[model samples]
Target: MTAASPPSASRPRYAVYVVLVLMVAYMLSFMDRVLISLMIDPIRTELGLGDTQVGLLVGFGFVLLYSIMGIPFGAIADSGNRRNLMVGGVLGWSAATAVSGFAGGFISLLAARAMVGIGEATLSPAAYSTIADRFEKRKLGFAVSLYNMGVSLGGGVAMLFGGVLVAWAMATAVPLPWGELTGWRLAFVAVGLLGVPLAAVMLLTVREAPRRQGGIKPPPLSALWALAMRHKAAFAAVVIGYSILVIAAYGAMLWAPVHFARAHGMSPAHLGLAFGVIIGLFGTVGLAIGGLLSDRSAKRGHPDAPVRIVLASAVLQFPLMMGAYLASDTTVALVLAAAGMATVSTIGGLQAGTLQILTPASMRGRMTAIYLLVANMAGMGLGPLVTGFVSEHLFDGPTSLGKALALVTAVSLTIGVALLLLARKAIIAAVLDNDRAEAEAG
Candidate 1:
């Protein structure tokens, strides 16, 4: 692990500020990304959509472009001005989200969502590369996980804020002021418009953190391929193994509220507050504990602490998800789901932190991009679609959703754990090798 460089040592306050700015962008991005879930019912009625189409809208539509664009954007982040890249991304996604308000049918809405994905593809890889440079290795896990607080918070705020908008739309004396938009349309417009000022703040206030890797052209895919092959086991463990669990994570994120609505006879207004608090508090706590545990374990001279913690989290997630999805009572299900949320959320950012330890500074951005490309495509892109397919085709009636979720949870987590176990030895070796190289360089 390298010591804090002069810029970081002398400008700790500014580093924190930059992290906060990135976090705001991350939070805002997620808010736009997931807000549609709260209005699934309204959107479905208006657009004449079924469960499969809804799944496509929230999952594939966004993730298609998001996954594909990651590597290109990641390469730019490695050698170009990352802050400016994000400025363009924020503005692009915000505008796309606003355009979602004008979508009248499936094709139009899908296009808008795809554009949002294209913009958001630029965020995480750039942000991860920057964090790796700004924080010392000792603090890397905590800093990355703290930045991931935006994820939990953004998801929670989407529901809570969407609930308010839904309530207002319901209580309106007449049509809304602008274009007579109501319900979900107004929600999209409101959240989308927020990006303008955030992009402004990002462009004007956040300075591009100095790249520790030095300004050099990024290696091409041929080189990155060779790099991954060298650490194939560890890479597979972190990427594919974790992606299996991500299927459950993204699946539940897309469908949990809808499950309660269809099966337990709950309304979005009530479920919003209930699940919002659960995801925000429990999920955030899970990330904090994961970062702390990994950092503390690393301090004790375990270089693979992050990988170990992620595997443990994935193991814990299975039972909780099964119990939640199969529970008979609504209160019991929410309790179990909250527990699962905590368990699954613990895996957040830890994988990226592990990669930071393994990859060279010059290629961290592209590496992170590769991780996201696979993880998001497999997990975020497919999770919702898979669940929807199972429910619509295999199961019957409304309550079938819970059963589908339970089945997916059972399979994904079990395989994910086994794969991670296999990767442990390889990760340990790689981490040790990286540590020696970094020490020699220092």
Candidate 2:
């Protein structure tokens, strides 16, 4: 059998279009995912709930299914039509979000959130795999960074838009669409509805690149397992380090508004605006800078450039997170919060680029699924829950929440720094081995 031609030498300009489409999808995914945070207070008041219950809704409730289904979704992304999977996932999550608006009680809302998780589980693996196939290695870091901007942007939209919606409802005394539906539920519906348009765009325009252009079958689960086992340290380090970071990130994301509102006595509108602007603007800038630096470092022959950047960022993050928690002034706290977010977010692109470099094309999705399982299981599953538990039980009051969050975030950052430093050598080795293999094969 003849060797299949390497995907045409001329890179497809439409690759940018594909990236844009995926980013839009990711934006909607995160917006739907995060809107609940903005609505937390109103929901708790309306439902007669506690912080623990709210944490469960945003944490394990969403993450349980999202993490479990992520692996199979990743595997399917490897072998199936990626664009279709993304479109379907977007639609699924969108409908789920809409249903959340109609939820009458705690259990119904939890079910809707869980369904959202199941649908979102399909997006990243497929998007990442598709980008890996489409972009050359050199440009991968920046490309991934650009895509990750969706997270920051989506998060900003969730808060800013949700805040505005809540303000409008409160100001107008407009009876919520449903008699019982008020703050958080309304936020959910508005954010969820935005996905419909994005889903339509994805389905109509985005085309899946051919899988395994060289006639290779997608790697079997055993092969993926063996690869992870063989590269045990690198695999574990990436997964664990990122997961730890995510715990801090998600916990902070869930609690920042609450912390600010209570600690600084800020209004929801002001808190949402502050968090949204800081996270959106600085987060985007930081991600772009990290991607650029990583790409430049790789070109200069440091395959571990992205990993090193992550390590440095984690180091800076320790103090920044602590500062955010400890600061008395709202402005000071917001500044520190922005710095912490920017520092931690720098790793967003680096992780994606590193995974793509280390894994072969056929196994990229499976490996990504493994990474997602570990990352989400630890990060999304436990981060907010642990923080909420600590704030409510260990610390036992609103006043202690900031200090508790600061302490945990500092510890997580420290652990992340250590793991990233350890993984540096392994990442370099993997990249070199991949480079050598490709050179020989060529």
Kindly give the number of clashing pairs for every candidate.
0, 0
The RMSD of every model to the true structure, in order and in angstroms, is 2.0, 2.3
lDDT of 2 by residue, 320-365 (tens): 8888887998788889999888876787667777788888788888
Q: TM-score of every model? A: 0.96, 0.95
Worst 10 residues of 2 by lDDT: 1-10
The residue-by-residue lDDT of candidate 1 on 1-442, one tens digit each, is 2232524756888888888889889989988766787889989998899989988998899999999999899999888889999999999999999899888899999999999999999999999988888888888888898888788888888877667777786565346455577667777877899999999999999888776645345667787788778888988888898788788888777788888888888888887887787677788888889999999999999979998888888878888888887788989899988988887778975878888888877788998998898889888788888898899999998778888988887888888889989888998888887778666645
Off by over 4 Å in 2: 1-12, 171-181, 212-214, 440-442
| Global lDDT of each candidate | 0.84, 0.80
Question: Model 1: how far is 299 from its true place, Å?
Answer: 0.7
lDDT of 2: 0.80
* Model 1: pairs clashing at backbone N, Cα or C within 3 Å: none
The numbered model that scores best in lDDT is 1
